[model samples]
Target: MKPKAPNVHEDGLLEYLEDIIGYKEKQNQLKDKLSERKKNMLKQNKITKILKINMENLLKIIRIATIFRGERTIRFDEQDLIDLKEELSRLERFLEIEENELKAIQESLKDMR
Candidate 1:
């Protein structure tokens, strides 16, 4: 005898299985995205912290340079001060950008909740 064709209930079960598979794929994709975002946030935070420390050290150097500017034994040129100030400005801008990016990633994580 010939084998029987798939009944309606079997077809319905197959559709349900397919749908479950699709949902599982979507869930995995979202998890991957969340993991990547968390890594980026961590990296950004580290970069921001390092930048702040460097900026603080630069400020200290500038202060010390100013203190020695009046001595007849030690002299600091105007061009040297200008160069230090320019470097400080660049670091500040870089830190600001990193902070803003970190905030954006945090906001996205919140929205995912």
Candidate 2:
């Protein structure tokens, strides 16, 4: 005898299984996007922390320079001051770029929320 063909209930079950598989694929794609967003946010946070620490150091250096500038008795080396100024200038430029990038990342994160 020939085997029975698939019944209507069996066909319905197969269609439901295919739909569930499609839903799972969509769910995985969403999960991956969320994970990438979280990683980007973490990187932004790290950049902010680093920027804060460096900014504090720069401010302290500025204050010291201002204080020492008024002291006539102290023989501060001009060369050392120039070197420090150059280094500080470089750091300031780097910080400026980092701040802008962090701001953009923050805006994107806000939109996602």
Candidate 3:
């Protein structure tokens, strides 16, 4: 014998099914968006860490060069000195920007707390 069809309900089951499907699709979309955002945040964190390390190394190099300049009477190549000076200036500017951003982040964290 053939099976009977499902009985129709007054509660509009078909509309409820459509709403459920729509809500599931929206939830899946939101999950995908959240995962993408998390990946981007991790990538940005790694880049920020690398930049901080590079800035620290640049500062150390500048300090060592300054110390050498003070200790030795040996004449350095003019081009080398000029290049070092330019690099130091660039690093200083970057450090200043990073410092400001770090302070801003700290302040934001404090506010959140």
Which candidate number maximizes lDDT?
1
lDDT of 3 by residue, 51-108 (tens): 6666567656656776887853224543544565666566556556655665565565
lDDT of 2 by residue, 1-113 (tens): 11332665444654566567785576566666656766665676666567666656765675677687775333354445556566656666665676666566667656644
**TM-score for all predictions?**
0.50, 0.47, 0.48
Candidate 3 lDDT = 0.57
Sort the candidates on TM-score, descending order.
Answer: 1, 3, 2
Compared with the true structure, all predictions reach lDDT values of: 0.61, 0.60, 0.57
Q: Pick by TM-score: which candidate is best? A: 1
| Candidates 1 and 3, the one with greater lDDT | 1
lDDT of 1: 0.61
Segments of candidate 1 deviating more than 4 angstroms: 1-21, 71-113
Cα lDDT of model 1 by residue, 7-95, tens digit: 75444654566567785576567667666766765676676567666656865676676687754333354455456567656766765
Error (Å) of candidate 1 at residue 28 is 0.6
Give the clashing pairs for model 3: none
Model 1: colliding residue pairs: none
Candidate 3 regions with alpha-carbon error over 4 angstroms: 1-21, 71-113
